[model samples]
Target: MRALFRGLSPFNVTRRLYRWTMKAVRRAVEHFRRSLRLQLITTFVFCLLAALLAATLAHGMTETLYKRPYVDYTLSMQRMDWETRHLATIIRDQSETDISALQPMLDNFEQDVGLRMLLVNLDGKVLLKSAKATESQVDLYSVISRAMELRLDLNVFHPQEFVAFYPVELAGQKGYLIARGMPEANIRYESTGVNMISVPVFLVVLIYLFYRFTRRKTGYIEELADSLLVISQGKLDHRVEVRGEDELGSLARNINRMAQDLQENIERERQAEKTKNELITNVSHDLRTPLTSVLGYLRLLKDHPAGGLEQQEYTRIAYEKAEHLKRLVEDLFEYTTLSGQGVQLYRQTICMNELVEQLVEEYVPLAEEQQLSFCKALPDERLYVSVDPEKFVRVLENLFSNAIKYGKKPGSIGVTLAREADGIRLSVANRADEMAPEALNRLFERFYRVEQSRSRKTGGSGLGLAIVKSIVELHGGSIKADYRDGVLSFHIWLPVPGS
Candidate 1:
């Protein structure tokens, strides 16, 4: 019930909605910022909106500054037309041919409303004029006649002024009364000038802003190109800067990773070259020693053929040298094959308990001959593992041989084989002087020896532990060494069948 309440809570719903909204907004913003098509569309939309706003404002200003005032003036003229019609009816009722008697009224009206008044007869003679119209020498009959024909009620344009005229009857005859005013300053002409100046200026500014925006956003591509050039020149340490969670940023991250991998690969190649050189030097020295000894013995046998005992001694020494040389060559060949990519394993299931016992028994005589005690602790339950029989035996033989050769005299050598939940653990331990941590760490490295002099005395080719490690790894097993309480131990773990 609590879970249900929590799920249905308004706060949870709002929070989830907020998160979804933010995620969508972020995606939209990223798309607009990263995609060229979207950017172009956005720019076009912004420009269009700006243009619409400018046009709307210009239209509003035109109405306010020009059209609205003109409309107000026309409305005022319409109100005055009723007043003028009444005045015309008064003149017709009074039978006045000249409106000079009402000149004061007309003058006051013209002054109040910003217009000039003129009265004309059928013969085209002006009978009355408002204040400040006496300077006009133009005839009004033709202008009034044209205005009346057009039936214009407001804003009648002439060459020098705007006019409104009303036809009326006076003394049973037709005549015209005119109201004239100077034209207002033309506002649309000034507005047109302003629009002409402002539109191009606004467009220029918008274009510049867009250029800067696009250039800043796309600058990452230039940086990427420069970084690629650096990498091409073998500077794998250089990296492009990542600025956003976008495709360009992802590309930069991938390029950085590639550069790091390239650097590591180059370092590995360098180390391999150095190791190869060391291996060649060591092999040459080891081979020369055995070959020189074999040659010396052969020469002694050739020079002293008559001395039977000396000849036998020479033959025996030469045979021992040849045997050591053969063992060295075989170890080198086996290590090379195992280290190479092409090594193949022929696997079989074997009882590890029996194998361990057989190996211990076979090495017991050699251990006893060296005055070293041998002990074995094996589980009664059979522990089976899949392995290459010949190679696996070689691994055990190398360990047993190492223990026999380097183990303390009169000390015990022990072997233990047991089953583990994950796999099987086999340990071979012998009483020996504790080795340095550095030596233990490199024990499985090719040509590595804890005691350089002892290596020569024991005829070790320095590839035994290396070969053992490679073979174990090939079988998907692991081997490690530990020393405690003056006992050197080699621990091996091999996976069980189907494990």
Candidate 2:
């Protein structure tokens, strides 16, 4: 029975209904927020509710200040009329005509009740007065006649006073009972006028507050519009300020991010253009010098074939210049290919220790020819790295060649390979003339060379270190150069397999 009652319980039913109602309300609210018309309608309804609430509060205050006191005054007058009737009835029942007998009772009524009363005969002549009469004499008969004609039981006793006269029958005689000296006015005319003025003033204030509220809300939209206009005028550096956590603020943040990206892209494009122009100027000068030498030597050889020994010397000079030009072009082409995003790499896991050892051995003869000593520091543990073997070998060759060309006379060229915590560290250092700190920073830029230490006699196209950097980057490695203690060092860090 308990289970049956639980299933039929009103509480359970109410909970289910509440859940459904809340779900529907949430859906409606979401819809209202998404639709502009619905949102405006909701705002209007809210403002209307606010206005109505303000009006209700004002009405309650008005009733407390004016209406209630006036109602209580009216009730007090009715009570006074009843008391007057009761006193007159007492006088008729007692059949008292002597002034002395009723004088104490009338005095007690006047003192206790705080009202002045009078009795008059059918002829409208005053027969008794409990208090002094301050007003001038009036035609009481005409007043009574007019009140009776109008069928009013009470009539105004005097102008501009809170006094009334009630007609009564006492001991088979018609007479009038007058009441005077009532309570002072509690609800004044001035207070009613103030209330009337305050209502319209309150309404005006409510409208102004609503207008400011709506205007502040829509002000964000206007800011967005102005921001878009400024951005459209090519002010990529400009950003919109975010003012809230709502959708409008999110849009402003997105616009700011877009502007930042556009500014960065534009700056990058400008730098690229400058770099392109520099590259063209450098390549043109290099190529023209070598081609002119080759052409001039070939022309001399062609015109003086019979001038035997001199002709052979001119032919040899032309051949050397042609080879130098070929090497320059090849280096340029290779650098361009490696710099491209679409260059495919044939990656394989190679033992870096063995590769370094082999490269050192290959460069030992060149070191000896240059009168530079070879120093090697390699670990026995095999370090494996995944890289394009051909490109990786080229990077090592470039460093070794540069060391051979630029090392000081009789100075030692050192090659060190070791396994670091993160990856493999390869350092190639050569004792050379101290290079400027600024030169080390730009050592890997294409066609860049330190004029003090590097020359055409080194037989390089100045793209070797740049090519090495590109290859290292393609293999997800990094390369940097440093100069310290008269030794220029190039450090390469390559990630180990699976690291």
Candidate 3:
């Protein structure tokens, strides 16, 4: 029966009107509608959800604002407890039961605070009520009586809510109580703040709809323009958006694919340029040795008194320089070929202990000449690893030279061996001259050196560590530096013996 009445109610008419208005909105979007319903539906749902969220937020703010001053008034009443405490003291000292016992205190609190006050009796009945703010006054004589009747045995210590503040003697039959509310309470009750619940929601949606309405027709065009800008700036991956089967999405797809291909081709050309540079560098090194030899022989021929001891001495020096040049050229050619042509490893079962002992023996004498403390802590068991012997030897030689060159005079050059989960870690620990870790990774790049003067004195072409990196990667191992506590540790991990 209630459902039938609601069906005929004006609320139903409002919903019907809203539905009709939406239908009219849909028909109007027809001329511009290429897949119009999707745009319309997405916009409508997003807007509706946003509106509901805003309304909820506004309602919460309203409740908080409206409740604040009312709660503040309640808090202010706490200070007035001092007056109530004094009244209790007076009632206790008084012996007379005259109207002066009540009238002066009542008039003072009522007139000064503008609060209505009432005194109720012990039989849950009103004995006295102050005459102030009569408009908002509540009658409680009978109500108080009923309240106390339900809770009998109301003593001073166990006083009830309104009566708790009121000190009372039974007077053979009743107790007294008082209640109050200020004139300011009326000011709080009629606040216009709570009525503005939907005001914030209205402003937010109004701003949003104005933006949507103003920019609606040009949204796609603006997006297309932005996408074109991205493409022009070398981001060919940008797409022109045709969210629907309209012209934009198709264009974007084609443009994005074009950008991807262009990026790939650019990467390929960069790699080719790198290879060409490597070729030129290798050729230059090869040419330098023969050119040095030719220059040396020509100079020897140009010397005056050619057949003397001085000439022999000069020829010997030239030959030694030529040999050094030949060695440098050879190292250059080998390095270029190994690094440029991605050489696959020919792995064999190699004893790491044996390899280390061989390199350490060779470098120990050199370390002794430099007054360095060189020591090895090889594993007790046979330390075997599967690696290319030649490449592995190069790895050992590079580390050995680096240690001898960088290790502080009289500092320890320690080699520690331990078995890892899938590999064996061989660490070459030495104290370096205050090198940062950020600079260490680049140590494996060509022409990179810590100190130019020191490097020149050490006689390295800066290719040793770079070659070490290439060989290590080819042999399926890894190398890193662990610098801590004034110790520079170069760690090399090679896969264990046979698998």
Candidate 4:
């Protein structure tokens, strides 16, 4: 009994019921959020219910108007006609024999039918009345007089009032019996045949309209599904037709964006694959050339082992080829490492002005050897930036070496470092023959050279600029080359503090 009572505890039961109710409410809310069709259906049902309630209220209000104490017009004209005729027959039979008994009968009939009743003699003298005359009943006397003068029965009806008069004889005397009240009110009920038919017709029309509305939504959904199918079949250009600024429209927009992004990614992948193939081919050819040269020279030395001078010349040539091969291999390794996705940079806050000055000084002799003069435009202030010192040095060295190698003979190599609005800009400018726009655009691409023959003559591996660009980007910097007025300048922009 204790366990049963505990199980039936009102507090526990209420808490459990509350939890279940909340869970159900959350699920309903989630479904409402996710399903557009459900939302539309809910709205459609609510509108129908509201319309039904309004119709019911209107019918009830009409009936209530008739049922009001002062307004007695709900009785139909046909019912009024029947009641009047029945009262006329009774008065004809009883009024002539027992005029005293007719007063009681008329009063009772007045109470039953809710009408004002009066009896008057031919001269218009009131002999009997069911109730006191009020303003609405003032017209009853005229109706009785008209009937008496005409010697005929009369029925007059209006929206607010009705008056009926009948010629009658009371104990050998002639008089008029008048009935005054409101006319029948216009009211509809569900039980009537007209209302029954109209209700079904209204429901049919409502259902048809709702069906059309839902069909439009379902049709759009089907179109979206079809577009998705087309996209799944690799037609990334296919798009959904956005109809309105609703959830469906947003969904369509998202689908279109997804398709566009997918298309772009596919094109990029294809380009990357093509680049990979070119890289393999270029690497094999570059590596094989020096390796073959080294092997040929070594073979010559091996075959002519006794000729000391010739052997030394061949050994030197082979050694130079080996060194070239070693440099190419090192550059290739560095390029691959820097181009990797997870390359780590050991960053430090270093003064870029001091670093550029130091590098310029170190390369001054090499610039002189190339018949190129250094034109330094270093900033006076110590502009600081966070970068991997070693990698940043390599970037500058690559640009400087390229400028020295390809610059016009006896021309000046401009090395500039300055502070800009957004960041610090470092540039290496050289006077060279005007390069084509296509070549300038691909200057930082792997294994790309302005002149393949000149690059081979200078013993360049062609990965230098590519590696430079990768390192600069790793430090949250950008590099670009521009050619104008026979001057090719490469600019590097680094965003850092203390500038």
Candidate 5:
């Protein structure tokens, strides 16, 4: 206990506790202020005002309880004097046999009232006593302590307005005594400990309100911060919900507007890329066609019997190289035009079944001439769709040409046109070597060449598929290629009228 007391001394413990408390208060206030638009100064002032008012009321209540006559708060000396005289009346009564029974009566009164009754002679010797012992736990010491601390004469209490009177008839004395006041009322801290904290009641309320407001404000700010991060990551489509016409709401509106502008810029950039791809494709094709013709004429000259043998071989080689160059140029032009052109639909509602039958019939002879079989799984129903008729015909022709060129000798080619939920699906397939998956990914690129069917022997300008892609997209549709089980297939989906 001695060591504990030393450790908890005011000099050491009190200063440290105060410093730590101050630091905690500062940190808490700073953290809270970051979330607040209100001032701590005003709150502290209000708490001070409340503390003063509450403390005044508490003092009044304690003083009032102390002064109540029902509590008999007068000093014990007066109470003892009045009770001694009252007991003397019973003891010295003129009534018959009173003196003989007086001691027992006093004992009975002591039992009922819980006071140590005594009668003393003039010499101060105890003549009679009823209770066994005197009271030791008196309230005087506590009252004295409070009086000294508060600088008040609490022991010298004022007499109560009401009083009790006793009329006593002793053998030779007739006397009357009136008693005023009793004992002081106690206000123990154990019973009213909650009142100590009541002095700072406003401080507690202020802290609570501060915490609640800070939490709400901090939550809103954190949400705004997170939304900003999302916007920065190219999510222009995202928007924040406005809280009110406050600073936070204004900030959200600005962020949303910026996102809108960014989305528009991205769209423009995409369109520009599309236009650039088209120009390059057209330039390549325009440059390649004439080059092919020139190379063909050069080959004619080299094959002539008039030409010398060694020189002729060199000329033939040169012609072949020129032809390769011509093909490359043609691919570039075809890819360019396909990219640049927008959808210009000469839309006509055409029966796709008869169209497919007629096209297959015309192309069947070509397949047979190459010792290959031609088959078509066409829709039996006369399927109708709005289409640019001429462009559609060209699209079919390009697909057929590609299939015929790449199909294995004496192998089969299939063309199918089917109705789909949203549109039409046209598939053209030719049996060939397994196509590279990477090749499929870039099949629409200008001059994109794969090792298998992409060689010159297959006789493609490499832009036929690219052209098909353009035509299909111009009609507000899409095209894709898949190679599986030795079948090189192209699929296109065009929107129907409702879809």
Candidate 6:
């Protein structure tokens, strides 16, 4: 019902929609950023479009600055041809009339249109000419004869300048009218060389743009390959630089992660090997000491045939040493089992107060024998916990034993069981030799002893606390040691039911 109300809420609906939309957008962006094929395709399309645009701009520039003037000149020459043809027709119509009357008109036309006009008779002599025609030379009879042979009334020519010839009749004979316009500009001719080079230049530009776009990707790939080679040569600390969120970058990240994991695993294996070696040395020393004593006493019993109190005393000492050896072996076995994977727990709910009291009472006699007294503070309420009874007993026994063995003479071992907000707190504190912080930290490590000789004297295999910690942790509890002043304390916190 609450979920329904939240779904129906306007603000919630809008917020959720907004979040979903943003998430989709972010996903799309991430995909674009990471997709290698998409990036290549996009770069190709962009380069193509850019190349086309560049070509278009070049063509437009070439047309305007190089080709435009030629086009305009061609059109001007055609208009000049038409004008010259019209003048020739007028001369043909008034051939017997005075041709000089047209001279003023031709001069006016030449000044206005910037052209040189000429009127020729059949003898190839210039009969009339414009002011600008002084610089113009013409073979009007030949031009007229060519036009007549070609049956052309209008003819345009280009040698050094624009020239147009039109046939006419002067004094009842064949003649011509000619018009010369401005010299043509050589812009198109000059740009022919530029046009030839432009294609190669454009191609080079396109290739450069392609290289600029793809160089980073290729360089990154090379760098990643080099880093991989270094890492493969056992340099697990080497890493590749991640450029984008693309496939290559993800591969680099994966490679880095693999290297780190491998490095850590190798270090862990080395530590485990070292620990195995130390365990072998410590176990050999510990077992040999008690075994030698047991053998020595048995040898004394065998060498002496005295079936008397002396023999019994040797038997008792040998038996005690054997017992100590047996206990050490059992502790070692239990620790190995607890330290391994998949340890099963026979969990049951039990009253923690009762459990603590029973263990303390059981250890009281041992404590008294060691000249230690018990100062236990257990809660009044029946605090409940789920734990394995056997393992819990071992945990308490180890702590109590350590307290009794290491406590100063005539000192008290304080055992406290209290309820905490998070769990149940049980502590076994004793007045003993002050321990350094380093020793305190290593108290629960396998085969670790604060003082090796002292531990041996007390018949401690150094596996008791390790086994205890392993059992407590297997039961989902934690244990720690603290030292303050002359007191060394072992604190165990177990989770209460439903904690």
How accurate locally, in lDDT, is each candidate? 0.76, 0.75, 0.67, 0.77, 0.66, 0.78
Q: Compared with the true structure, what per-residue lDDT tens digits does model 1 show for residues 1-499?
A: 9999989899999999999999999988878666656766687677667766665665566543442221224344455555566666666676655445678877887787667777776655677778777733446656767556534545433324455666766656676777666544332222223335346545765676567666856687888988999998999989788877556777889999999999999989978965874585468566767677776767666666656787677676766767677677778767866876567899999999998889888999999999987788998899999999999999999999999999999888899988877899999999888789898999999988877784567548889999999999999999999888888999999999988
lDDT digits (tens) for residues 352-434 of candidate 6: 99988888889888889888999989878888999999989988888888888889999999989898877889999999887
Instruction: Write the residue-wise lDDT of candidate 4 on 235-347 in tens digits.
Output: 99887888776588789999999999999999899789658745854775577676777767676666666557876776767667677776777788678767755689999
Q: List the residue pairs that clash in candidate 4.
A: none
Give stretches of model 4 more than 4 Å off: 1-85, 93-163, 168-175, 179-326, 337-350, 362-372, 385-391, 408-411, 420-423, 431-441, 452-455, 473-477, 482-487, 494-499
Overall local distance difference test of candidate 2: 0.75
lDDT of 4 at 44: 89
lDDT of 6: 0.78
lDDT of 5 at 150: 27
Error of 4 at 206 (Å): 17
Model 1 spans > 4 angstroms off: 1-312, 453-455
Compute the lDDT for candidate 5: 0.66
lDDT (tens digit, per residue) of candidate 3 on 4-105: 998978989899999999999887665335555466666667776777778777786676556533222322343344455456556545525664467677
TM-score of each: 0.46, 0.48, 0.48, 0.50, 0.49, 0.46
User: Relative to the unseen true structure, what is the C-alpha lDDT of residue 315 in candidate 5, on a scale of 0 to 100?
Assistant: 81
Q: Tens-digit lDDT track for model 5 on 91-142?
A: 5564355433557775776565444554433332344456563432324334
